[model samples]
Target: MKNIIIFGLFFLMVSCKSNPVTKLDNKTEVGLKGNWELTSVSYPNSSYIKINSFGIADSQCFETSSWRFISNNNQGEMALRKAGCPTFSSDITWYVNQEGNLVLKFVGADVKAKTVKEGYVLKVANLTENAFQLFDTVDVAGKTITLVYQFNRIK
Candidate 1:
């Protein structure tokens, strides 16, 4: 009877041991949980472009800065504050497309904002521990311009 009691106690103690929780393997949507930094940006079909300490400049015509990105419910938004001449703020609504691409919708901003008539689409070319790349396109008039914006994780 004592031996049986000892076995039962051992069994109970073992059963009471805490088990570690297992995380799900597939977490694509949850992948955008951390902070990211801008590394490189390219407007493939644009006439000319530049990336400086502030933000990005296009064709020596426009300059922008103070960028912020946020994502929730499979929808995302990227906002930027333009510096230099003709200052303004812009907010672009973004989402993950069915083809695992990122789509951007140009949402109107304040008084100094540049009203965009259309949108852009991008894809993740490379994702790493510290950096990633996004493939996109900017419509300069009626033309389809492709672009890739690379970013690094903010440590």
Candidate 2:
């Protein structure tokens, strides 16, 4: 009985698997620490289709939007300023997840981030010193489309 128990313990220990390690990239966040402007939003067949990004106003509303990303505390703010568009601004808490995705939570309404139930996740791509792109995939008419958000450094 002792021999059987010892073998069982060994087998159990050998079969146990540890959690996978997360590949979080801090370099991407470092590169994003600055002021930027949302230059454009585009997708396939965008001439005919309109998309309201971030569940906010029309895609055009985000044009010329100012964004400030503070790398120290992972805090930021975004404001939209366009004629005939809904006014919007928010304090944002953001981080790059293990998969190199940008995770964003809006906490501007004097609400704690922990209490915010919804957030936005976007794929970071084409990162450069002066520009980058955020890709968002959405389903329209039973088809998947990639939406691109272009950012340009304000220098």
Candidate 3:
């Protein structure tokens, strides 16, 4: 009878840990579903350091960019409308993972996201209804630099 109780307890413990709970912060995700503008892209230590933002455009190019996020399907679009910069738009798939990291994959011409290996992972920070920020760290000249993308929700 002791062995049977021990086996039952073991089975119960194993069953309880079978599936880990995942909290995706639905409130934050819902709050992000809307139109927003990239007001500023900044970093610490210096403001004139040259670097490309999102591997697609210069750090300055992302300023004043327009973005739209649809939470229902996790699809979005970002348009670059800055003067003298290349005018372009791209479809993107994004979601806030359990770790609070925003996973973004740009799509093109009916392309499958799983097949594409290129993507950007940015840590979400200071999320509010009106403003939020995405932080990315990159190595430049053997130093780790953090890039902050500040967004303001468009009313």
Candidate 4:
């Protein structure tokens, strides 16, 4: 009876150990749960103009933007800080699709916010504990433009 009890306890302990793949997935999810600030935006296929957050002149709204992803709830918020500009805050539903694409669905009442209504699906070029990179391609004026957005986790 004593030997059987010891074996049972040992089996339970081993069974409770988390799978390595699950642990790694959890770590990646945790890494994405935080506030992130847009650091840079680049148009690689076109003019190759790389603009830093501070150097954004055309659109002040995007110059001071931040995103917060809530891993537990699978929700997010996009805050645009455009001083003296129309304030805009977007409640976003985010998820990783089966193909590993990062998808963002915007929920709001603003009719003018049509750009995000259909949802934005971006390729996750890179992701780490402190940095994230997203890539997408859009057609404008019959030209294909590749946009790369780089973000840094906010402390």
Rank by TM-score (best first): 2, 3, 4, 1
Worst 10 residues of 1 by lDDT: 59-68
Candidate lDDT scores, in order, read 0.51, 0.90, 0.88, 0.67
Q: Model 2, poorest ten-residue lDDT window?
A: 17-26
Candidate with maximal lDDT:
2
Instruction: For candidate 2, write residues 28-143 as lDDT tens digits.
Output: 98999999999998999988888878888888789899999998788999999988898999999998876879998888687899998899999999999999999989888889
Q: Residue 121 of model 2: what lDDT?
A: 91
TM-score per candidate: 0.48, 0.83, 0.82, 0.63
**Model 4 bad stretches (over 4 Å):** 1-28, 45-60, 82-86, 109-117
- In model 4, what lDDT does residue 50 have? 34
- Candidate 3: segments with Cα more than 4 A from true spot: 1-23
Worst ten in a row by lDDT for model 4 = 51-60
Write the residue-wise lDDT of candidate 4 on 46-117 in tens digits: 344433221223333454578898888777888767577456677777766545567777667653334654
Q: Which of the two candidates, 3 or 4, achieves a greater lDDT against the reference? A: 3
